[model samples]
Target: MGADYLKEMFGLEGQTAVVVGGAGVLGGALCRGLVQAGAKVIVADLMEEPCRKQVDELTQLGGQAAYVVVDVTSRESIESLLADSLKQSERIEILVNCAGVNAGNDFLDATDQDWDRIMAINLRAVFQACQVFGRHMIQAGGGKIVNIGSVTSHLPLSRVWAYSASKAAVLNLTRNVAQEFAEKGIRVNAICPGFFPAEQNRKVLTQERIDNIMHGTPMKRFGEPEELIGALLLLVSPIAGQFITGTHINVDGGFTAAWF
Candidate 1:
């Protein structure tokens, strides 16, 4: 009875979820979580090869899964992703914006191109996807959206100026959109992850930086990609997260809670 009750509250048996950046490490974990919860998963990303691979893996796990190539930097491409995903599922019940990029440099050494590129993928792309998918969810009656944020969203780290700035903006945008969609039965929230070893930040996580992270993080360990699944499920689950919106979960090993 307890198991049944938990499933009733958190199971996504018939829902459809589109996970943008589903090919990446953390994103892949989020995709797996959604699928395991019983939602049909659409793996959306920039490269068809990676997206296909992710879908294949999800299918192997006994999940209904497919892929749609999306260059989040382009609005038209985002719209196309929606059209393609709708072809497979009647309506999308959840959207997870997980696509992101990063670079580290001294303030004087940052380039305009880098800043623009990071913002395009990390911040602007999220805004576009929310608007596009939010419209669909509104018409479909209701849905959930989870924007992937970073510990930087709350406490900016040194040397990753654009990434920090863009993440901060994403959290702000999540709240604003949440308010706008609250009356529409759509809940928008964010998950701020601490340091996880992902491709986007590989270049930035030098040994010294790793030490600094461990020092500030109370847990003294980097988070695993899979560790984020619980928070993701909570934010997107209709029953468990029904009353949760316009807020964020900091899954950062208490990094955000530390004082020193």
Candidate 2:
């Protein structure tokens, strides 16, 4: 606490951060973390209430914030979000893609619609948000993007075929964007989370699912929304993760490492 190496390295004094899907659990935690770092936040989500709640809470805490209803599945929504943020802040320094959905299905039972919808919300949204916001970063020198993938991207999780594939795409897409944008100063990275309470899997989060997750995770515990804050900070904070890009930070409690 004396010097706070992390603080020194990752202070977001006047930066503006956009958290897509800021209403949900993990997204809300990220909003708070960035707000605490002194970044003005724009909470974008599918629902207005949740988005407003996030903005209000941050404002109550004396942090700057704004909210907009965004359908990550739409290019227009994504474009408007970036346009509005720029109009308001003149600059956007961070973009975090936390909006995603799980396509619940066995690999063999998965339908084309199921796969497309999952990819649209999870994988495609990330790309849309990046391109829309990335243009500004490219114009203004540079920016940082932190995309949320899943641990399943690396390890197959049954009954979520499309979800897993979409996240896998996200991981690869992060690397590709990082390589293309590195010269532009736009660093791209991803966070592959194990599990947490959120809207993405509300329908599938049963006791059986919880037990299955615990069995796979070495820690035998599901992650908390707050647990993601540190990793997110390390990635988006310009000084902290300046050199860290094109990598996926797994916050899954060693879920991918345990086999036995």
Candidate 3:
């Protein structure tokens, strides 16, 4: 809001950050935003093409960035990501866990494999990333962690039972990590976003789904990927968020506040 607020409170210059799932739309937006604020970013994704694309975009825009292929479902992949990250900057002072997915199956149609996959990617991935990179943060003396949740986790959404359940778990995971690591100087929190078209929801968000979302959202529009930058910066910047932890800031443009 003011120069002092930014100059004194929201500085992230020169910090090294790791953003899991940085290949997707929202994740790409976050990587660029962090770069603008002067944080060195590692764009970690499951695939190389999209991840490299993000790195190219950031480098073109004069930002410090790199790519790491990570399988959120595997412990070995997480370890490699952290290892490669250290090779680049030797520290992951800030991490944003965005490696999540939704199979979009109804509870009745959901199978065991579907359940396991969602849990591993959406919930356990965050747990693994935090535990691995979090150890680095702890050794270095402090850090920031932002886990991504979704509005559907709490909203009465249909045909995505496992996704909702996993996201809900993230809410508690954020708090628990915070409480356990606060004294050690790691701040963990989650961001529960409202409906926005992404890789997972594209198929379901047809014309009919658009009508439903716009009608339901108080803002009456889908959120742009850029809309999340400010809140992200606030949470990741220890200067601003040193006293904030075990909490979530909803950036849904009033999607949760309205029941009408």
Candidate 4:
């Protein structure tokens, strides 16, 4: 009975999750977690190769997963992703917006191109995906959305002005969308992650920057990709998280809590 209760609270059995940017480090971890919970996962990304690679990794780990190539910058591409997801699983119960990009440059050196690109992928893409998937979820009754924000979403850091701004907007957008869909049974939330080393921010982690991050984070260590799985599951679970929406979880190891 206890096992059944736990499963009833968190089991994603027979559900379908579409994770945009599921080819990347953090996204891949979420996909694996969804699979472990008995959900069929669709790994969506810009590149066919990386998407396929992520799917293979998930399958090898005994998870059911598939790949769908997408260009988040394009509305049509995101629409295609939604259609393809429906084709694969007949329905999408969970959606995770995790695709993002970043670059480090002196405030005076930042260019319009850099800002535009980051905003397009980090903020604009998320907006579009939510709208497209949200309409479907609303009509189908309900769904869950987890948008990837960052520690910068709460507080700004040096050297990544555009990224910080975009992430801050993401949290705001998450709240607005969540409020709009609350009565519609669609729960929208954001996950603000701390400094984790990933391909997108690898170049931005200069030695000096790394030192500052360690000092700011109470944990004094980077978060492992898998460490975010629990929070993701909590936000995605239909019963356990039924009443949760419009808020965000900061998985930054007390980074936001530290003043020094």
Candidate 5:
């Protein structure tokens, strides 16, 4: 009975989810969680190879899955992604924006190209995706959207200036968009993850930086990609998260808490 009740509240059976950046490590984990909860997942990313691989893995796990190649930097590409995703499912019930980039440099050394690139992927793309997908969801009656944020969303981190700034903007955007869509039965929220090793930030994680992160994190350890699944599920689940919106959950192993 307990299991049944839990499933009743959290199960995603018959839903459809589109996870942008679904090929990356943390994004892949979010996709897996959505699929396991019984939603048909559409893996959207820039590379066909990784998207295909992600679909194959999700299929192996007995989940319905498909892939759509998208360059989030382009608004037209994101619209195409929506069209392609609808080909697999009648309506998308959830959207997770997980694509991001990061670079570390002294304030004086930061390049315009790097800043633009990071903002394009990490902030602008999210805004575009939300607008595109939010329209679909509003027409479909209701849906959920989860934007990927970083611990930097709440507190500034050293060196990765653009990344920190973009993430902070993402969280702000999430709140504003949430308010816009609230009356439309669409809930928008964010998940701010602590340091999990991923391709985007690997170049920035020097030993000194690692030590500093550990010192700040009360858990004294880095989070695993899988550790974020619980919060993801909560924010996306219709029954469990129906009243939750316009806010963010910090899955940062006490990093944000320690800041206060």
Candidate 6:
């Protein structure tokens, strides 16, 4: 295929993308990918410093980008993010819900607080973000939303009971929302990632757990942060992903395919 043909299919020139949780590792990579694809990116997160830092990084890379402080736990806060995004870029063409939290605890030892906190950030926040962004997209005629799920979304893992349940809910919610807005020119989908160590998961990635994950994964290794960008670009591209929705892509290194 010609370079022009490929660009035509995936170019995001003049588009604006809002990446919630863009301050963190995986989210930061997604933000950079969006920028590289020619979209003006808004790096939204809970803290100003890190969000601004991401914007700086993108700027240094010669990409159009900015930052917005957001607290995804609140619907009003999410709405404010949408408002701020519009004010900065005129419109939002894509939304990536990457803000999430996890905890590792035995099933019997999982506390109500743990479950509530995990669900609040992982599931409820995605719901609120989708509703807020989905409404705007419907009114604007079209948009793309990519929610972050996990390997636990499909398979049960030792510990992380609340995290597993929350991610599972995220996957289901993605489908339901995708179907709900299919006729309205809005696409909702998910990316279920396997074991990729980051700040959020470091607390849980003990030696024993790492050994188990490697054994379960066919590739016998963890995924690189940048490895997720291709799938993300495909789902967010207006031309390439026009008909794709209500589905998920598992970037799990065959972990979901492996069984002992």
| Per-candidate total of colliding backbone pairs | 0, 0, 0, 0, 0, 0
In model 2, residue pairs whose N, Cα or C atoms come closer than 3 Å (at least 3 residues apart or on different chains), thus clashing, are none
Q: Residue 187's C-alpha lDDT in candidate 2?
A: 91
Q: What is the per-residue lDDT of model 6 for residues 1-260, given as tens digits with 9 covering 90 to 100?
A: 99888888999999999999899999999999999999999999999999989999999999999889998878889999999899988778899999998888888987788988899889999999999898898888899999999988997777887888899999999999999989999899999999887998898998888999888999999998899999999999978888999999999899998853
Report the C-alpha lDDT of model 4 over 1-260, residue by residue, as the tens digit.
69899799999998999999999999999999999988999999999999999999999989899989999999999999999888898889999999999999998988889889999999999999999999999989999999999998988788888999999999999999999999999999999999888987789998988899899899999999999999999999969988999999999899998954
Q: TM-scores of the models, in the given order?
A: 0.98, 0.94, 0.96, 0.98, 0.98, 0.98
Q: Of 1 and 6, which scores higher on lDDT?
A: 1
Clashing pairs in 4: none
lDDT at 187, model 5:
94
Instruction: Summarize candidate 1's per-residue lDDT along 34-99 as a digit string, tens digits.
Output: 999999999999999999999999999999999999999999999999999999999999999999
Report the C-alpha lDDT of model 2 over 1-260, residue by residue, as the tens digit: 55577577888988999999888888999999999888999998999888888899999888999987899888998998888888779899999999877756657876788888888989888988888889989998999999998887686677877777788889999999999899999999998888887776777787888988888888988889989999998998878778998998889899887843
Which stretches in model 3 have alpha-carbon errors above 4 Å?
Answer: 1-5
* Range of the 10 consecutive residues with the lowest summed lDDT in candidate 4: 251-260
lDDT of 6: 0.91
Instruction: Please give the CA lDDT of all the candidate structures.
Output: 0.94, 0.87, 0.87, 0.94, 0.94, 0.91
Give lDDT: candidate 5, residue 4. 89
Q: Which lDDT value does model 1 have at 229? A: 98
Error of 3 at 246 (Å): 0.6
Model 5: weakest 10-residue lDDT segment is: 197-206
lDDT: the better of candidates 1 and 2: 1
Looking at model 1, residue 175 earns an lDDT score of 99
